[model samples]
Target chain A: MRDVYIIGAGIHPFGRHDLSGLEQGVAAARDALKDAGADWQDMQFAFGGSLAAGNADAMLPIMGLSTMQFINVANGCATGGSALLSGYWSIKSEEFDMGIVVGFDKHPRGAFNADPKASGLPQWYGDQGLMLTTQFFGMKIQRYKELYGISDETLGKVAEKAFQNGSLTPHAWRREPVDLDTIMNSQMVSDPLTKFMFCSPAEGGAALILASEEKMKQLGAKGVLMRGASVRTRPQGSFEVFSPSLDVERGGTPTEVASKAVYEMAGIGPEEIDIAQIQDTESGAEIMHMSENGFCADGDQEKLIQDGDTKIGGKLPINTDGGCLACGEPIGASGLRQVYENVIQLRGDAGDRQVPGNPRLGYTQVYGAPGLSACTILSAA
Target chain B: MAELLDKEEILKLEPLAEGLFRLDNGVPVLLGGKNKETGKIVFPMPSGAEAERFDVVPLKRTGKLWSWTVQRFRPKTPPYRGPGDDKNFQPYAVGYVELEDQVIVETRIMGDPDQTLKIGMEMELALEPFELGDEDKYVSTFAFKPVA
Candidate 1:
């Protein structure tokens, strides 16, 4: 396989928006192409990702319909990462020299209470209030705490960092810095996870332009080399959201499965990563994912938060972009939003939230509903 | 067996299948399937042979609370058809119950509010009214009650 590099990244600020999903996607795409110093015609292919929006490729008419291979994809919360993987492989396989990946979505306020029937689940599942994403996060964390001794304070610190980081991020939705006490005292959505710890289902768009090694040189564009791109689904027995039942014996969750292959593919270990952007749908999620993604050991989150190891000036700066906690999760866009932040950080373009010392390697992982995960590794080229 | 026959007129409610749960020899049990090949048991047998051939079995009536949380707000509708409207919405407990280390089933916990739920607490399955039905009858669904 040939090498693939990301030439440009762009995002529409995450939050409630009056613009149509298509318009938001179009804007992100436009910004990315402009940043890449390329024209719409230069894109050999386009892959669009969104959750509720139907056929993202429908935006072709507004995007200069160059008759490129356009495909629309939906992978729940990991939709953006899936689109990025598609574009990455397109260039790596030498099938297309360059491509565009865009993800956008709009959702109503309140908990993401999904219709069970839509996903082929029994309606009673939803009727029983078992379908709320908040419930899943709460349950997962509750179990994690039971086995690991994770404290509410540790969980609060995660949100505190996110809001603090979000305060510095212009594109983040919840830009006000929140204190640990504020997060802990916020109304409880589910036991363990307070309302403030949960990310709002938001509206936004993110886009990236990827080119083959030769194309990058041709355009004289310095880009972040794609070290690894992978997507995985839950194995039987792995506990996850929306599952009616789980196997008594645990198996590797999607994040663990996907990140293992990602590390192998990148020929590097988690110890080498300078920065990371992981799925933080809730503060506990970020804490659990830190261990699941192999960044740290299980039950290590307490010390990690207490010692400030994950903060910006710390050893492993995570979610420098404020993460889903601060940005509010615009499902389809959230995954790629992580990648965009990593790119900007590696490029030394991130202003206030930049990690100290020149970071070379970055990692990102996004988890989707009903069990799906995607990971991407990028490095300064 | 007696409760099943006595409540024959009361429907099982929408989305609650006819054979999902039943009283066997006076003991409530969830209908499940055990894979002969892998010895893996799944609640409500999954469709298709690729899921492995399984023998229908009655799951354990009692289990231990594996994990839990309380839904502080009522879920939106189109899928949720439980009791109470937005104005009168009441919080409810939800959790996964482990049935003897075989499988963990998601279930609604029936009990008093503000009652602390700890992991590994014993629990037993029970049939309760889910929604009111035609006439004086009502739809009954399964819920897990704390076993004292």
Candidate 2:
């Protein structure tokens, strides 16, 4: 099998750019090309993920930007990750020596138009008041409090941690300081999840350049080998309560199952990982990620956060790019945005938020499918 | 979309081609429809008992703020058509009730969206109209009432 590598990476901040969707994508794509020391003409194909099509009008971001070859994808919040998966496969399969994956979107003002007719929620209006991702995740936070006796103080502390880190990143949606009192008093967006606990919806774009080993050698790019990339969906569908893709009882989910399969195939373990990013659509999700990534027990992800191990200077830095928590939750751009953090860290470009002791192995995870999930593990050559 | 079948009709539908728990044993249950596209058999979320049964016991909730968020605008599905006569219900509390059985079900809350939500609070599910009604049919949906 060919060893594919990420040669280029670029991103705009996680808030609204006030630019057209295609313009945002083009800007990011140009940076990616420049970062890789490769030009747009050198890209063999392009895959784009944009959550809001209405904002962009006809001809997608990829079609507007790339002339050679293209495909566009949108899987709810997982669109960005899906784009990366497709680009990786294209280059790894020798269909293209180099592939460009771009994800960008300015979230619609309110709830995303999930076309409720398609989602099988038992709601009268599909998911009028109850379907926002924050509401569902808030349910999990409530459940955790019921079990662990986590204090409101603890949750505020978690919020403070994210904001403190967000302040460090110029691209974070929220860069202000949030103290324990500020987090506790913050307005509620969902139950148990204060506004601070929830990642804001922002307009943003991120791009990645993928190249086969031979292509990277020709270009002389310092790279992280795309060790393994895999995607999985719930056997039943996105809403099935019994999804193997998320947190199961004792073990990680089908998404974790897919990710573990990647690690097994690459002959690596989670302990070997140095830097990581997991999708945190909600604060509770970051907890689930620890156990899902073998960092903790299923309901015990909060302990990791509470203990400060999930912090920047702690063991195995995560979401070092402020995560989706600090970074805005741009549905189409989130997944690839996670991947961007890992690439920046691996290539040693991360400035203040950079993990100490120069990390080698990094992983990025995204969940979509109308709730399908994907994890991509990248490592230094 | 549920029909409260009369007791007699409920007994008569038994021995259906499907839905039989066991022929002459327990209640027969019918599962998913056949997937004509994939020529594959599929069964959606299945329930062994009905709300009326109330026998097997629902895992009760002690308490918890399962999660909460604002419904910034009206939904795009049934029950919500343009602005109804009364707009008092705009931006309502959207939440999930985490039953003791680890069951997480979505619901509307009894309080305001900006209210402080405590996790692990006792929660009970109640049926209500999905939104402001048209004075005709009521679309039944679940809502959570804190079990203080």
Candidate 3:
């Protein structure tokens, strides 16, 4: 209903951290407030979440005891985006002038193990080892490769680029370039997907300060306009993680639905997006999401990746901060990290990984288990 | 009907879970749920409160391989009851098999993952023995083997 802008953004470096998840959240929130030239008292309301970490509202005592409405969100990997959108709606409705959206998580090292019973699935599904997320990625990509003629070399190239970009990103966990051969030859976690192509469960935090246009001008803060934000869950019959069965008739994925909605709300097409950060939970996810998000055709990624067109200083720089591949997925914090990277890219402050040619429009998409996707479109103010 | 009843005997081996499959005329058939009103089918059937909404039906034993991959690493315990550690864990193939016009079911593929599995290949349901983390005890779990 009203215009919202991101006045500031901050992130605690994504990887293993000594600080607790809540502490990391506080740090990122403090950094964002400082960057916005605002204090804790300035936030009228807040929204935040974490997966393995404790309650987000717990940051209140550590920061300052305020009566601000701090709603805790838990939407799988879309936690950060959901928090940001909640803050955006609060401002858009004229209910709050400014607020904070933060996300943090610290997961134990290893592939995430979810309880099948919790998800209402049969226990035998888990007992039989059919509940793995990695296997789902492998199967999905294996099928995509068959139908679209995607080469294993292209999948390897995606990881190679992620590491190359991560080497340039200070906040990235895997900050060294790994060659394509190494990526292709790495221990096969799942067939066609090697260890190097996957993102491990890790820890980190990120935050964003959202304000109405009135507050931004009053504070003299340079803002990034939040043109659109949308989150969608899987429709019936769509393939997703942790499913023991699939429908006979296929349906659209949440990413496709959310991406379409956000672009429509932003009043722009994928071609106009200068910089983009879609979910790269794994190499194949990045490859599939490229087409799902309407950026390119189903098989176009083969050439787009081979020619390095998706690299920095290319046609469209994607995941300039290395995405989940190098950052490691921290669940709650992962989605907001994408936005934080876009903010820095838009401000032209991303030192080495910056997309050249004065990028204007930036887009981000985060997707996770049980078929959920959240998307945002931001433009330089 | 009497001959059909004589052939319709539940396999003697213990299944990983009940109501997953039974033998039909000496052939393994998956038990699926068919929505009483909509005719939509689902694998493993529904249990508990949801069970009342659908009718138990035997699904086709043969299907086409939709997609597949090899589990090269040991999954975490508790959720995974298979016997093995990092050193001795055997890599197994898993994939979705499309059962004609019915539901596509996810199942373990019994074969050499690198050499035998191919997309769109015909597969038939069979019961595979899964170790239950104890010595000499096994349970039958449904899997799809390449159709010769």
Which candidate gets the maximum DockQ versus the true structure?
A: 3
**Model 3 regions more than 4 Å off:** B1-11, B134-136
Residues B1-148, model 3: lDDT tens digits: 1112221232455778889988666577899999998899998799999999999988988999999999988888868998978799878899999998899999998767676688999999887777788445667789998998
Docking class of 3: medium
Best first by lDDT, ranked: 3, 1, 2
Instruction: Please state the error at residue B145 of candidate 3 in Å.
Output: 0.6
lDDT, candidates in the order shown:
0.86, 0.64, 0.91
- Residue A102 CA error for candidate 1 (Å)? 0.9
Show pairs that collide, candidate 1: none
> Residue B53 lDDT in model 2?
26
Question: After superposition, which runs of candidate 2 have C-alpha atoms over 4 Å from their true positions?
Answer: A54-67, A120-128, A235-254, B1-148
Candidate 3: tens digits of C-alpha lDDT, residues A1-381: 789999999889999989999999999999899889988988999899998999999999998988888899988889998998899889989999999999999999989987899888999999878889999999999999999989999999999999999999988999999999999999999988999999999999999999999999999998999999999999888889988889999888999999999999999999999999999988999999999999999999999999999999989999999999999999999999999999999999999898999999999999998789999999987
Which residue window of length 10 is worst by lDDT in model 2 chain A? A240-249
Residue-level lDDT for A339 in candidate 1: 95
Candidate 1 per-residue lDDT, tens place, A1-381, comes to 899999989888888889987788888888888888888898999888888666788789998879989988888878898999999989998999998999998887887768786777766677656787788899999999999989999889999999999999988998899988889999988998998888888988899999998898899888999999999998867888787888888788999999999999999999999999999999899999999999999999889888999999999999998999999988889998999999999999999998989999999999978798999999987
Candidate 1 docking band = medium
Point out the higher-scoring one by TM-score: 1 or 3. 3
List A-chain TM-scores for all predictions: 0.98, 0.89, 0.99
C-alpha positional error of residue A252 in candidate 1 after TM-score superposition, expressed in Å: 1.1
Q: Of the pair 2 and 3, which is ahead by lDDT?
A: 3
Error of 3 at A112 (Å): 0.5
